[model samples]
Target: MSFASDNQSGASPAVLNALMQEFSRNGTSYGTDEATKRAEDKLRDVFDCDLVAYFVTSGTAANCLALSALGDPWGAVLCHHQAHLLRDESTAPEFLTNGMRLVPVAPFAARLDADAVAAQIAAMPDDRPHNIRPQVLSLAQSSENGQVYTPVEVRALCRVAHDAGLRVHMDGARFANAVAHLGCHPADISVRAGVDVLCLGATKNGAVAAEAVIFFDRTLAREFPERMKRSGHLLSKGRFLGTQFSAWLHDDHWLDLARHANEKAQALATALTSINGVRIAMPPEANEVFAVLPRQVCAQLGAAGIGFAEWYGDAILPDKIELEREILVRFVTSFASNETGVAAVTLAGGVLSR
Candidate 1:
């Protein structure tokens, strides 16, 4: 059983089949192919709006391109301190934005707190280039901690960001899972919630590796195609990227995959709560469950060939968990997670059986 990451899973059967079908069809290159067109149409249908979208192979490229499209080089992108764009992307956002600063703001309830963001935006010294004006406000759906943001929460942050002349960007790395959990239309928390651009991810849900940089405010995408081409994200035979999304989104297969993962995570969280030495840290709003596991249980799970991500830091973790003897672990369930796997891990712990 592996909970290392959602990326550990293989592509969904539908996505694989779509790719196989595309193998025989000869199409134009660089997102001009039939598969590419099909994927774009699927997104428009999913979000229920006309928009511009570009397919890429990684979320990094999607975020970088989408953010760069909204801000100038001297501007700043405000995002949660623990956001993937801030901590995990390894300067890609900076390099692509040409040194556009990713200013970290405190996140409350697993999202960019509207008050904190507004205060930061106002606190900036905007006296004629003395300091960079914050131009973008970025928040992650199914946040890094695996908590989902509600539509009302999204609307508040968006309103605050927009009032201060800031464009909103959502790092939807687990977009499908968030929507599946919220039981809301994709547009309800995104475009309709005032997000200017979205880095919609499919790879972590069920695709092999495909992401979309979607501009709900189509005007922000004016120079994005040229930027994407220069950044090497514009795949030559882009049909491969397109085929993944085309099949993953068809018939709402993406939501189906996400629901399975979220169910497994919720079940695991419930089981872990009964264990003697485990404490549900973040209480999982999506497919990721963060819990404090006793050091002995950690060893037991590892010995049984079960793997997990040992998350560091006590930023959001409470004082109830003893950091000295317990480790903060992230248990991530994906489309591939099954009941058998969850049982083996939850029951395998010697510490739990006590």
Candidate 2:
């Protein structure tokens, strides 16, 4: 019944079963195990391309290690102002890159516009001696405000970054949701869109704790293993991570789980729209629903033990919009969410409105 976050939902049954099966088997330590190889193969097949995949325990490690590889200590990684890497990671990216700065750019609907990115880059100081050069452009696939970026948009941004001598990285913590919503191959929007590196997340959608830092550009990833090891992100018993990915990617289960979450989010968003004094703050993309609710309704939902969070960084709202007696909140649906939970929240909102 929790609409707090997709991570609040536990691992998918398939992933958990795979973990149990791998627990009893003997395999090599580190990432050299056969299971790890199989997981890499599965990912290659899923992406429809040959690329390098490194499994890590958390999205933070994956993103930090990937960015560290793409940028130098004196470089900057440009991204949306509301991105998790900029707002939530707590300087891990800077720490991993030894001093790389995260430069916030123009954020529209929580997505970075290519023109805006170009303008931001163009406005940076050209004094290489004293200014940090923009090295990497990091885009969140399903942005923090629950908005998804289309393939064309991603390609345009990548082109802008690459033409400016900046490598592109995608913080794909909710990549499956974006892919499922787009109904396109994962490679089409990311690898083929000229993304140099991708932090593919599995923990939020269905896995217990598995995240992959995928390198579409081989050159950018040549020394990533060293970076991962130095950052202590290399798990000794790596088969556990492999097993989870193997099961999650098997038969396209990852997309199915994401599709379910996305569908639930849509349902919740639709329900909220029918309530008076409630307004959807952003497009209900992926598994997150952002909405502005009356203060009384928010208090009622909170008192009823319904799980959600107060979202403060909504970029979609106009500056002139009145917020005197209302607040923006985010409701996240996961593979485990169902009609019952969604209905409960909406029904409460309706009752509270009366």
TM-score computed on alpha carbons, candidate 2? 0.97
State the displacement of the C-alpha of residue 111, model 1, in Å, after optimal TM-score superposition: 3.1
Least lDDT summed over 10 consecutive residues: which range in candidate 1?
312-321
lDDT of 2 by residue, 96-194 (tens): 889999989954545789999999999899886788889999999898878788999999999999999999999999999999999998988898999
Model 1 Cα lDDT, one tens digit per residue, 47-141: 99999899999999999988888899999999887888988899999999898998988543345678988888888787877778899999899
Query: Candidate 1, clashing residue pairs?
Result: none
For every model shown, what is its TM-score relative to the native structure? 0.96, 0.97
What lDDT would candidate 1 get against the real structure?
0.88
In Å, residue 335's CA in model 1 sits off its true spot by 0.3
Model 2: number of clashes?
Answer: 0
